[model samples]
Target: MDPVTFSPPLYKQRYQFVIDLVKKYKPKKVVDLGCADCTLLWKLKFQTCIEVLAGVDINRAVITDKMYRLSPLPCEYLQPSERPLTIKLYQGSVAEKDPCTLGFDLASCIELIEHLETPVLEKFSEMVFGYMTPAIVIISTPNAEFNRLLPGLNGFRHKDHKFEWTKEEFQNWAQDVCSSYNYTVEFTGVGKGPPGTEDVGFCTQCGVFTRSYQSEGSLTADSCRDTEHSYKPIYNVVYPNLCDGTILRNTVISEVIYWAESIRKNMVECAQEDETVDNHSYQASSKSVPSVSNISQETCSTEEHVLTDTRGDNEAYKEGNTIFIPLAKLFSFSKVQKLCSSLDHLKAILSETSQVELNSDATAMILSAVEDIEEHAEACWDTSCLELGVALAECEEDWDEELCDS
Candidate 1:
């Protein structure tokens, strides 16, 4: 069978169920036993709460074949979570005991248990619940009762499945594991059956086991003893992150402040132009100069400019050594507003960033206390750093006003 016959695709639904649990549990260390193609690890890596992500499969060739897909994408380089993401893929078996796989907060065995021989299940259970003993374990397998509903599925869902179990049998096995390992178990499933088929439950059955007692002989935090290693490490990746606050202080904060000052300057120029128009003494500058950045003078303000080019003659803002690029301003340009269509998004970034101080309304920002940002900026400024956008400015302002008021 192609395995893509089910609605929403059965594999995808299984992965989504695990992802939902991950978001709720917020596990720090996660491992997937029998992680064949590693599609689950790829999805799990995006969850910020997972500090360490591991995948183990019996076939070295099978796991290594998908390693390239795990490489970080280009955009992930620019923006990463506060916690560094570490992903490791291993070549091993669920039935084997590996010390290196111990102490995971969550362990998964998606559509893998039925593939093991009946006798091997003992070893699999012992290795997972007894030895590695993660705080939580999720095991999913095809529900034999739902097989009659699948269009072309034969004797079993897959040829590799050594044996399939009914819901009662699966639940009995799960209860045995829980009893043996001192873990609590809950049974749930995904993929709805046809209208009158509710009695059999979902197409895929899953069991979630949570540790009820601490494992005996748990390794000390500073233990010098080296535990045994069994799984062969295939690939590892450490993503660039904002944990150190340097990127937030340097690139994000500096760019925001630079744009905020530019907005203030433009607002002042617009007011002056209003005064000049009223007095009938307005004079267009001798030379028409374009802006230093892509955002033209017309785009930054609602009013028109007809006097001396007041924006520092299109000069880049520089202080001492660092030349702050107006990336925020560039993003707000009419040509590129899609990148930053609303200033509220920018405000959210500023509000969440560590070492960044925002006034009660988030109109003003303080960054001097941060290590890499300017120390002199510890004092609050009088300008609203993020009050404008391009075409979406008005909607953004309304949203910001409502959000900030709360």
Candidate 2:
């Protein structure tokens, strides 16, 4: 049978609905109960509000193969996360009580309930809503009522689905679970039918169950940090954040190098324009010095933060194949407004790191044996920031593979 596809696609719509909930409630800890291929877990990692992310699936092979997709991207370093985010993928059954997946703020089961047998479903209800008892529970299942709207369909949507609950059946089951677990539920769905098919509801039915912790003395996240150790470790990674000294040093130095490289490219362009007006203005053989024209003098040189060469003084200088970039010019480069929000924030971070230091007057940022990026650009723009590019690439490659053994 051909796979059933929706306008936005049923799975995408379902994941988006959950992402919207995550944005609204800002849950710090979230776990996907039946993360088959980990597509949902991969998407949730981009949501910065979630600090602790986890995925539990019975299919260990799939989790192990796809877990690398959850790692931090290279751009994440240019602007680090405000809060640290750690992601873990576990191999386990949702029916069993697992300490590794416990005490989450939000629990998600997307199109997973219908796949469970009746006996397993009962256990899942108790384990997820009763023992774990997260503040919010989101569950989505295929709506049997909407099956008629699908083309060339049969008894169930998928052969693996033991049963598909009708709207009443799903809601009644939800209400019963809420009543048993002391929680309230909100009903919603994704994928609309034809204009007049409102009565049948969406293609995928969802229930958002919320409850406030009572006097039963629920488990705090720290309580189950280790205890039976129910879920088997698959992969785990902690993203680089500013709170650590070494990570901060690496992050700051890389940012400064890239920033300086970008400004150097612009400087080369301005120097070319200045060299056009006066043939003898710049002598690369003597030292890196470029004369400034009236337009440059009025617009850039007098800005106090832009490069200065109007009076024959070089804003950037070369000595024995080493070059220095003025911190004032780099931090105030007109183009950097798009790259950084607050230059002061970078300055503070730099001061905290010992790897890179400012000159005595704090006027220049001295990088040792820095090759001319202009030469690297002769190959391509990609090679211009070689030092930073290699650093970031090495870091990302570490996260590109499975982080845990078995």
Candidate 3:
């Protein structure tokens, strides 16, 4: 079957969001979990400097010889010669593959959770988080609230989907998984509408878990929904903060910061070790070679110093200097920054208002932050950055009154 033919409209938007995140991380090797036709892998190959982009899927139909010929766009776009990107397709299940063994820098499971049984979902999470040491993993699934908004009961029913989850359910489940395995959890989405809209029906939630790391739980679903829903739409988009450009920019900045810090720490450690070794060597050699050479007095000493300096310069050439920063760490810093800024903004608004009561001040603060981020994200147009900017702008349209107040 042609995957795109039956796919939802929001798939494009979701794909763009995932691709942006991947680019921000700049993974050297990317593994797409449950990649139906690897359309996302093909698109992401163009956006980031990924050396290896591989897709794993259970459906053999999507990867057959005929399908490769039939679906030329994805393959053509992924061709290294044409685009400076390399992609590999693997037909299998994510649970079966060990990401650590594969040495993937980053991995993604987009819109694949609803199809798995609970046990399978748990296993899948373990494989990605436990076995796969990828610094960053992106997972997205349908929001139950949006599913309810579908035309009828039939809307929630998908032939392949084992189960659909409400926003609360997915959040709760994700929090547990992240907490168990030391991963940070974040929630965001695509499209413009009220709490739920058909065009942006699916809820794109990304669980960015790092190895053996934990963060204090901040906002709960009820609290978040209360704040988010009370704040009326300023434009066509629902939650302006979740816009694509803002997300991409935030992710990119955070990744850079994280990598920079890691590099600095490693350099400091290496320098300390080098100093210790030099001190030990000098102490031991002091006895073998007289502190002051018994040369032809001053003239011999001057000639010996010059030769020592030359030898020192040549010795420096023997040591190689190379910098290495894991791609996942580099990309995640931007995500951390964006998410931190967003949470801070949310906290600032919440602090100004009563927990039981939602006020206009809180709404205004949210709108202001969204606008500020959107303004700053103008330069990033590759992939879905431009479209995301427009979406956030439209969501802000409903906040005109709030903007005026500010």
TM-score top scorer: 2
Enumerate clash totals for all models, in the order shown: 0, 0, 21
Per-residue lDDT of candidate 1, residues 151-266 (tens digit): 67779878889988999999999999999989999999998876777998989999999999876656444331454556676766666555534333334544555554554455
- Least accurate 10 contiguous residues by lDDT in model 3: 228-237
lDDT of 3 at 318: 16
Every model: Cα RMSD to truth: 15.0, 8.1, 26.5
Give the deviation of candidate 1 from the true structure as CA RMSD: 15.0
**Across residues 285-348, which tens digit of lDDT does each residue of candidate 3 receive?**
8888786455358897798678557853112111123333323333234444444455444334
Q: How many backbone clashes does candidate 2 have?
A: 0
How does candidate 2 score on lDDT? 0.75
lDDT of 1: 0.70
Better of 1 and 2 by TM-score: 2
Query: How does model 3 score by TM-score?
Result: 0.45
What residue runs in model 3 are displaced by over 4 Å at the alpha carbon? 1-8, 65-85, 99-101, 194-206, 210-406
Candidate 1 residue pairs in clash (backbone atoms < 3 Å): none
